[model samples]
Target: RLLNADDPFRKAYPSESPYFTDMGMNTTIKQVEKVDDQTVRFHLNNIDAAFIQNLAMSFASIQSAEYAAQLLKEGKAGDINQK
Candidate 1:
């Protein structure tokens, strides 16, 4: 949910989130595009070293759109990362 502006997870960011900016998120990220099952694309407003490092953070995992859609269809989207 890193690119989700209104995601509740953003409000619960850890106090010591080093890769985060004073704005609470790396606003430098302009967009994220899923190229395929094995590839993705990130659009950035500028080159920020911290953004690169943010990829290594535990929460930076790539989510499966197909799985997300399945959850939505099943009315259990909130189960993401919980199970």
Candidate 2:
């Protein structure tokens, strides 16, 4: 819900941001599933050797969708520092 374009957060923010590139969402993510309230599953289009490592990077930080939506609502979305 957060990463997909169907949500307002993804729509407000660019798919590829300077802070982090959503490589899987851009290339390898064939599908996403909400397994439970605490879990989400990613179905990759192909094998990715660095996928786990990339996900562990600080650049891959997850931001609050509500905050992002608020930023966009206030027109302060672009004011966010990528890093």
Compare the candidates by lDDT and give the number of the best one: 1
Q: Which digits, one per residue and each the tens of the lDDT, describe model 2 over residues 1-83?
A: 33455655455456544333445445766777889877778788899988777778665566666777777788776434352
Q: Clashes per prediction?
A: 0, 0
TM values, all candidates: 0.61, 0.57
**Residue range 4-71, candidate 1, lDDT tens digits:** 64664443443334544553356787887889878778898887766657677665665677887777
lDDT of each: 0.64, 0.62
Question: How many residue pairs of model 2 clash at the backbone?
Answer: 0
Candidate 2 residue runs with Cα over 4 Å from true position: 1-25, 80-83
C-alpha RMSD by candidate, in order: 4.5, 4.1
